[model samples]
Target: MLASFRERFSMLAAVLALGVLVGSPDARAETLVIAGDPWCPVNCEADSQRPGIFVELARDIFGEAGIQVEYRVVNWARALHDARKGRIDAVIGAARNDAPDFLFTVTPVSHSRMCFFTRSNSRWRFTAVSDLGGQRLGAVKDYSYGSVLDAYLLSHAEDPTRVQLAHGDRAFALNVDKLLNQRIDVVMANAWVMENWLREQGLGGQLRNVGCRTPDLPIYLAFSPALASSPAHVELFEAGLRRYRADGRLQRLLQRYGVSEP
Candidate 1:
C-alpha cells in the first residue's frame, strides 16, 4: 500500500509539471482587477472605443500567463483607496511612487509627462513647490504630481484655499474655465491628458504649458498585496511584457490607437 501511494504521488507531480510546462489552464483563473484614472490616449474610461493603450497591453500580457485582467475606470482616488484596501488586484498607468508598497513589474508599461497649464497670457510658472504658496491652483482630486507636489499638498493641509480639487467628468473643462476667468492661476495635469482634452474641447490654442514638467515618469503594473496571485505572478507578467516587447506587440498596439513613439 505504501509503494502504491508513492507511485500515485510521483505520477501526480509529473502530471502537474507537464500541465504548467504546456500552458495548461489547470490552475484557477486569477482575475486581476486593474484600476485606471481615465487619462485619454493612455488610459481612459472603458466605454471609450479606444479604451486607452494600457488596457490592451495589460490584458494581453497577463493573458499570456493564463491570468485574467479586468479593467475599470473609476475616480483616481477611489482606485488608490481600493487597491490599498486589497479590494482590487492591481493598478495600471501608475507612477513608480504612486503606490510604493505594491509589487511593481520589472518594466514600465508607459510614461507620463506631467506639467502645469495656464492661460497663454499668464506667467504663473511652477518653478518650485514654494512657488505655489498663496497661488490659485486647480488640480484633480486624488491625483499626485510626483513627490514634490504631493509633499506640498500634505504640508499645506491647513490652507486648502489655494487648491481647487475638481471631481467630475468635466473636471478638465472646469479647470480650463477657472484659469481662463482668472479664478485660478494655474492648473496641473498630465501633459498627454491636457493635450488630448484640449484637442477634444478645441481649446488647444488657448492654453499654454508652464513647462514645470516632471521628466517623463515610467508607468508600471503594480500588484496589491491582497491580490490572489502566486508569488511568481509578478515574474510571469514581467516575462510576458518582455516577450510582448521583443515581438513588437507593444509598438503595434500603440500604433493601433494612433499613438506615436515617445
Candidate 2:
C-alpha cells in the first residue's frame, strides 16, 4: 500500500509538470481591454506602434505581471457608455467629471490645461466664461472643460450660434477646421493636445491659443465600475505607477512623447 501511494504521487507530479510545459489554459495571462477616443499623447491610434502614453504605460505595467492589454479606439461618449456596461474594461485620459462613477487611480497620469484657440489673425480672447458669449464657441460633445465652462456649455448647448458642439473621435480636428475656416470664433481645447495636433498636421502657425481656463485638472486611467476585476486592476496599476514614477521611468516616457510631466 505504501509503494502504491508513492507511485500515485509521482504520477500526479508528472501530470502537473506536463500541464505547465504544455501551456495550460488556466495559466494564460489575463487580458484587460482599454478603450477611448484618439486623445493623442494620452491615447492614440490603436494600431500604431507607439499608441499613446497611458496605453503604453498600462501595457508595460500589466505585461510585467503576467497580464496583457488590448487598446481600442472608439468615440469618447460610446467608450464611456460601454465601460459603464462592462463591454469595455477601462477608459484612459478621463477626467473625474467625465466619468465620476468609474474607478480611478489615486495618482494622476497627466494634467489638462483647457485653452481657447482662434485663428492667428483673429483678435478674440477668452478672459472669462462671459467672454464666450457673442462668439460662436467650438467644443467637443460630452467632454468636461471645467466646472464653469461645463455649466456655460450646458446652458448654451441648444444655441448653435452660441456654441457649436462636435462629436466623434475627430471632434477636436473638426473644431480646428471650423476655426481655421472662419466658421467658428473660438475653439476650446486641451493645450497639450492642441500642441500635438498642430505639430502632427504641420499647421503650427495657423492658429494661436488666446487664453486658457484656470485650474488645470489632472486626468487618469479609469476602469469600469461594473467589472469585478476593476479593484484589483486599479491596485496593480497604482503600485506599478508608483514604482515607475520613483525610478524616473514615467518622466522619461512622457519626454519621449514630447509631453511634460504634469
Candidate 3:
C-alpha cells in the first residue's frame, strides 16, 4: 500500500512539472505580422513564388534580428486599417505622415513620386493644382492627398466638382477606362506603379504623365503605435533595417524590383 501511494505521488508530481513547463511564457516564440497591399509592387504581392522588393528586404532585416515575420497581403485600405488597429505589427512601404496612428522608422528604404496620367493625345497640360480645378479628376478613394490639395479642393468644391473620388478592386482599371472613354479628364497614380501597370496592360504609349503631385515621396517601414511602443522589438527591427540600409543591401533589393535610386 505504501509503495503504491508513493508511485501515485511521483506520477502526479511529473504531470504537474510538465504542465508548468508547457504553460511557461518562454515556451512560446514571438512573431510579428506585417501587412501591405500587393497592388503596390514595391511593397507586397500575391505571388508566393515572387515576393516584392520591400517584402524581401523586410524579411531579411527582421530575420537577422532573430524575429519571425509573417507577411499578410491585404488591400490598401485594409492594410492601413489593420496597421491602425494594431492587428498588423508593421507595413512595408508607406508614405511618410500617411497615418497619425502609426510610427515610422527614421530611414526610408525606397522613394517614388505621385503623378497624373492623362490621355495620350490630350492637349491639356497640368502645371499646378489649380489646373485640375475645372477638369474631372479620378483619385483613389479614402486616400489623403495632403493638406495642400485637400484645402484647394475644399475651396473649389462647387466648381466643376473639383475631385471625383473612386474606389474598389477595379479603381485603377476604371480610372484607365475613364481616360480612354473621355469620361474622366485625368487619373492620379504613383509614377512607378502606374508606369508598370500601363506597360503590363500594353497601354504605356496611350498614357502621358501630366505632372507630379510632389517632388519625391519617401517610402518607409511603418509600425503600429502599439508595436512601436514596445522598445525592445522595435529597436531590434530598426537596428536591422539600419544595418541593411548602411550596407546598401536594401538598395540592391529595391533595384531587383525596378525601383530607382534617388
Candidate 4:
C-alpha cells in the first residue's frame, strides 16, 4: 500500500513539473493592443476578418514572433492620447506631423497628400490660401493638414463659416455627409484615403479633388512613446517592413487594398 502511494505521488509531481515547464497557452503568446480611427485600406473596421492593410501587416509580422494584435476603433484624438499615456500599443495611419512625439519605425508604411474636395460642379478650386476666404471647410478634428492649412484652420476655428471640425471615430464620414448635403463647401482629407472612400461608396461622381497644396508626407505605424516596449516594437516593425518590401508582400498587400505602394 505504501509503495503504491509513493508511485502515485511521484507521477503527480512529474505531471505538475511538466505543466510548469510548458506554461499556460496564454503565456505563449504576447498581446499587442493597437487602436485608431477607421481610415480604410490603412486600418478599417474593428473585429473584421479583413481589418486594413496595416492591421493585417502587423498581425502577419508580429504573429511570426508570437505576438497577437488586438485592434480597436477609437476617435483620433483619444487614440493619440491613449498611445501617449501608454494605454495602447500603437496608432495606425499617422503622419509624423500628426503626432511628432510618438515613436515611429524607420520606414514609412505609406504616403499621404492632404487635399480639399468639392462637389463635382462646384467652381471653387483651391488655387491659393485666398481661395479659402469665403468657403466653409469641413475637416476631422486632431488631424494635421500641414503648416499652412493648420495655421489657417487655427485662426478660423471659432467661426463656423470658416472652419468646422468633426469629432468621433466616424468624423471622416460625417465630413463627407456635410459636404454632400451642402452643409459645408469643401472637405479636407488625405487624397488617397478620400479617393478610396469615394470609390468604395460609389460617390466618385458626387465629389472631386479640387487640389492638393501640402507636400506628400510619409505616414507611419506610430507606437506609444510612453511604453517601455515601444522601441523594440518599432525595431521589429522596421525589420519586418524591410523584409516585406524585399519579398513583395508589401506590394501585394497594397494591391489587395487597391492602393499603390508608398
Model 3 stretches astray by more than 4 angstroms: 1-28, 153-160, 228-233
Residue 62 of candidate 4: its Cα lDDT? 73
TM-score for all predictions? 0.79, 0.88, 0.79, 0.86
lDDT of 1 by residue, 1-262 (tens): 6754653454345334434644673643456688866787777768767778888877776565455778887766777778878888777677767777778877887777778888898766777777777787888766666887877666664455777777665576687788889888888887777888888878867899886655667777777766545235566566666666777888898778666544
Clashing pairs in model 1?
A: none
* Candidate number of the best lDDT: 2
Model 4 CA RMSD to the hidden true structure, in angstroms: 11.1
- The candidate 1 region of ten consecutive residues with least summed lDDT is 10-19
64-131 in candidate 3: lDDT tens per residue? 53446788776667777887777887876677656656776666666767788888888887788878
lDDT of 4 by residue, 79-159 (tens): 999999999999988888789999998899878777889999999899777899899999988887777888998899999
Whole-model lDDT, model 3? 0.66
lDDT of 3 at 95: 73
lDDT measured at residue 150 in model 2 versus the true structure, 0 to 100: 89
Candidate 1 matches the true fold with a TM-score of 0.79
Better of 2 and 4 by lDDT: 2
lDDT by residue for model 2 (30-129), tens:
6789998888888888999889999999999777656689999999999999999999889988899999999998988878899999889988888888
